[model samples]
Target: MLLLVAAVGILAVVGFVTFLKLSPQSTPISSQPSTSTKEVNALSLYHWWTSPGESAAINSLFGVFKNSYPDVAIIPAPVSGGAGFQIFPLIQSLVNAGEAPDAFQMHAGYEARPYYDAGLLEPIDALWQSEKLESVIPKVIRDMTQFDNHYYSIPVNVHRVNVVWYNQKLLKQNGIDASRLTTWDSFFAACDKLKAAGVKYPIQMGPTWTASHIFEQILASQGVSFYENFINGKILSAQDPTLNQALTTFKKFLSHVNPDNSTTVKDWDDAIRRIIKAEGAFSIMGDWANGEFKLIGMKHNTDYGTIPVPGTNDMYGLCIDTFQHPKAASHPTNSDRWLKVVASKAGQDAFNPIKGSIPARTDADVSLYDDYQKGAISDFNKSTYMYPSIVHGSGMPSSFKLKLNDIVDNFVQTQDINKAAVAIVNQIQSTLPEFTKVWSLE
Candidate 1:
């Protein structure tokens, strides 16, 4: 059975390589060549975008694609979870069994390396060249989309991960000056005051990913140089003094989170909802939470307000939404067709406005974006300290990420700074064997 598995794997690699060499161009949007409402049958797409706001944004893209490829059936398999943690392993299983979806969502960085290296992905260099992506996509993000010199995915939107949103009413009612709290010291002081004013949970929180999400923002908040150093593997362990401080501070911050957390409200949207309703003072989440507010017709700055995670004003923590093609896709042509639309300016314009994320395309219709998005776009252009999010699949591999999530979740539950710091180093050491070649942990 082991031999059979190895043989199958080898064959898959050979087949994919040959296909890469033979395929001259990706299935362009013009492939259908007709505007008839003929069904080309179903194509399964797996993603984790079941939230109200997420669905609206994704459906916007569907509306565009359906107009062109009216015959091709597009089946959506949306799982409910932030960061697709529940769906990542499931995708691996489908790939292993040669039953992969036509196309699936992926983070366009080291996270895609394992699948690409395993011959489970279809290269889209043809599509990139035909679409002239180099001229439009930012060089930094475009570079991350490639593996082994081939582009394999299309980035749709970019979400800022290091944002703190608060109910404006709550802030005013509690005599809090949101603008003055630009550092952790000031932020925590405000949290203290909010607490004294009988604000039970000043900061709304969700489950493991939410905790890990805030931790990364806090880690980056220390210093962009330090955050970049850690992500680049220049800082070897969590035992490092700066990282220790961040971890200890993380433990301190947890006390402000609502005690009726995770068990009652396990979704980030729920946490955001609490903030919007004036029941909670704040929520540290990605800009997608802004989309949730927009979905309910809530106005920004009035209903809710946003600030960079304290001390991260000059930094932009990015969480890019990208999609990848599977080598064993039952509908490869349809998959590429779908991706073509995702990479187009029109699709990005339609999608990002409803998604509360900025378009990945540089030429997107910025006029169509809201105030929050306009602010994010301006920051994306100006921020000197832009970095991909560690918690959101841009900074680490699956195994290491899973390990980090486990440690952080445990730490959130226990509030043990020393143990958490030690566990981080230990886990990284164990994970190094699988990642040393890819990571620069010198």
Candidate 2:
């Protein structure tokens, strides 16, 4: 009886040990899947920077990524078109065809909002958290890229939208000192001098979007709080007397622009040509225009001087650009590796200088930039004068942009101030619903 009981006990112990070995939790470590070993092989990147200078700038970034990941091959697919032409249609087609690149550069505004809403954009929240981008990029830029508590895109640099690039020789010839013109009245006074001196086009303006940008500058100078209130739908219409005054101020400036000014000159390159040849005494445009000036061998603060848009106290505004990542072909590992490299510190440092804007990273040293860029960086540090570009913010989607373009085009052509004001009011009323919907989502 004792031997039979001992034999049963030994069998039970052996059975229990066999069951433990077969359990899922007890699988050998080598047999389990490992996430760390995953690798990316190749990446396809798409962007709209075809200009020689822009290509050079972007190549520097690509070079750095290659250095870091020599094993991962990068295929750059560049799309031609300066900033504002529609590239979305092409991207939409590619996505529908199941050929979306691993990553593409997009605007930071409502232009990107649709992609985020559609779930086409991969939320970089996980990557941002891992990299602590919040601590690296400036709060303003970080805030601009984020929507609904998540970052949708990365801003490579910040460009001042409300800049008035002027011909130093032209201004001096007219005895008009740009320094004394801090307010709208003084700015208009200078324009009057230019006009009186037979400067046919005292201001070079064009591109439907640029007209809207000018309107935004006027609105911001009035007071960004006022602009925000209207944009948020707190003030329903432009019927407010303040709105009328802003419209009037814009119309007055419109009168001094080129007579042939129409949306037809809807290209920055065309505007640059007019400026370089001194056909237009001044141009109210973004700092990116500096690239054109540089190409023409114009010296900053000498051949041309940059000033805040007339009547605005701030020298800074929206900074916009795109980042491209390698396309994920057969190798998911290569695609992932390229994404990681673009988001790294070395990548930003290599790209921003050639791109002509301060690095999106706040910790970057601005001393490496040119004098104009250094000044821009210093002004941005102040933070008090900064506001996002309207086109980059709520001002874009409300269809108010289209209406403002119409108003400016009309005001410039016919000089009908009252009609322009009324048109603006109607646009405000029509755009309020869309504007409210977007802001509420925020």
Candidate 3:
């Protein structure tokens, strides 16, 4: 039965990919009204939400959309990657070919600006006012969804990136209280204790992007003020002592990491699997790890425990998932319909619980969310500082992001702190234009 179900799912995703090749010549009436009996209207939805929990969450939102517009079918085009690295480039290619999906998933901040600047995106400010989203969504989120005072996309959820997940049994066996890991000094000490207790890979991480994610968290741990300065360009990588400290600290972290699976594991969930099997003591990852945990029937605070990554208690690393309408959408009305559903409170309520993220809406019901989500919500509402995630395409431009990922990946493999620091400085020195452009847009 599982195999049969898996086959059906694969067939559905395959169908969506096939539809992307249907050119104007193939569908002569593609421009006609969706409700017209002569035309079959379909909305193509592209995203990386292919995991079990994410699939279920998206289905919940699609269910609401389908009920309201029974005549329209949603084509799901999901791609796999740690951080949409594999899928986003494909999305760019589709845009270049004028075959963009009706509504596609993207990060909320500077990530979407390149497409917007190229005149590939269509603004949804009219729907924003019509749906009265201003009352429900937070002002910061509203600001994030806009470029040049025009709302271009609707944010669906906010993912906190600096979460540390741990195997509760391993920690207990090692006589290390999880609460003591609130700072780097304590965390390293705990790693030592876990090593002494025979726990391998006390800190588990995946490939390229995961290393970047950890690097960002280490920078955040320096303090909110320093993080803001660093990301905002007030501080330079080579000139700032704190930046050097962060790189050095991250390099030290690699020593405790299990080298055996560093190359073998490529997905974030794979690292979570190691922690689940008790082979690793802890993993610093985004809250989405909770979704994977639930997929395998692991209960939070029981089989696992979570905390803010060391020295980041009052800070939230933002990774918002949003949907944007392309100017070249074949079915503009259908795209609007999809966006309306995604931006609605009902949509957030249906999707966020399963996706392991807090609703972007400030007015969402807290009771519907799990304990971790509720905690995220509470922190988001009153956090001392909120910073965009560098690894998730918000803090830096796409060009700088790719370079930083390459640097972090190399650093992870070589564990050469000085070389990594110089590489980062050189990249930042050369790619300041890209970074500056993104910052100015904000």
Candidate 4:
């Protein structure tokens, strides 16, 4: 009987061990939310790259990621609206609500500084170093991602801002040679000729960010370093001669624009249409504007041609769309891994072509691009003068951007050149202190 009882006990012990091995174990339930350490099979990305072309460009990176991490799935949650105005506010709300995405697009500028300062961003400095991103990317572009010796973002492209897109048919009809108009004086001369040739609006401009972009281009072409220092608060005097010169030049340029521009135009699309129909002779805009031109099947350099803003000597202002990893405990490992792929060489090759910007990587082969894009790439390669876009850089706060917009709107209406210039200077003086204080906190 004792032997039989011991046999039964042994069988029961063995059975229990077998059951333990075969049965699914319950995961430890903690009062704290579960953190995911499992290999990340999915990720959510928030961005404003909703345009078909932009989406196509972004998908290239997605394709590469899938190849590298076959198990990972990238869910792109695109938010539609103007980049600075609509999308950023939405991101701010999400961060406040503790529902930020795994990663999101950010412009490499003082604008991104706020998010970094808020402790919402995960620095990818180590990943950048490990990937040897410096070897691929230009120093100017790489520097834009770094703040205080650490990288906070991955640069995807370099936008040439000070470009003038002109209507070729109109120029040919007017017997005007674009090549001859290389200097500011010659550019203004062409504008005058276009105006005299019964061109309704020799130059088209709207009341949106494009206006400020044009202003920045003019300022940079004149003396980028001076404006850079002015924006950074290193130059506080409003009456600085360099600034006065820029303002004076801007006033002259404004004179050549459509007189009824305030009532006539609404946005970039409007300006593009006017230029396309030869209603306007030229539009001063960034290289990204080429996408709109191409969308309409306009033959580049034949239907239209691109040139640097007059007076600039092979200078290109950088406007980069970067992705920043948001701090998330549940997906930290995956987020870090995904960021490495973003800054990788494959990412640049896939992303820039469709996005209508040159790769931020200096080593990128741009042979696949069209003539206009190739022109931009060539200029970028040969560029010695590199500056940040005033629209993006200028460590000024969002509130300041709004204030400047108001100032610009008023200036545009009044057409009082001196008063307008003074207002701009005064606004800078008032806003510079706030930006300085915020930047100093770093």
CA lDDT of every candidate: 0.79, 0.65, 0.79, 0.68
- The TM-score, computed over Cα atoms with residue i paired to residue i, of candidate 3 is 0.90
Error of 4 at 20 (Å): 42
Could you give candidate 2's per-residue lDDT for residues 308-370 as a string of tens digits? 887666536774764432222223454455556666677766766666667777777666666
Off by over 4 Å in 3: 1-39, 237-239, 260-262, 436-442
Candidate 1's TM-score: 0.88
Q: In model 2, what lDDT does residue 74 have?
A: 62
Candidate order by lDDT, highest to lowest? 1, 3, 4, 2
Please report the candidate that would top TM-score against the real structure: 3
In the range 1-442, model 4's lDDT, one tens digit per residue, is 0011111122222311111111133232121234563433455566766545566677878887888877654546665543355556656665666655667778886778777677777778788888888888876667667777788888777777788889999999999998787777888888888888788568888655767778777777666566556556565555667767776777777787776555677556567678888888888877777777776678888898877888776677778888877765224555676777777767777777666688777777677677887878878777877676757543355556666666666666665656756776677777664563322111
Pick the winner on lDDT between candidates 1 and 4. 1
lDDT of 3 at 148: 85
RMSD of each: 8.6, 15.7, 4.5, 12.4
Q: What is the TM-score of candidate 4?
A: 0.81
Please give, for residues 78-157, the per-residue lDDT of candidate 3 as tens digits.
Answer: 77776766656666677676666788888877678677777878888899999999998888778778888899999999
Q: Which 10 consecutive residues of model 2 have the lowest summed lDDT?
A: 1-10
Instruction: Count the clashes in each prediction.
Output: 1, 10, 0, 0
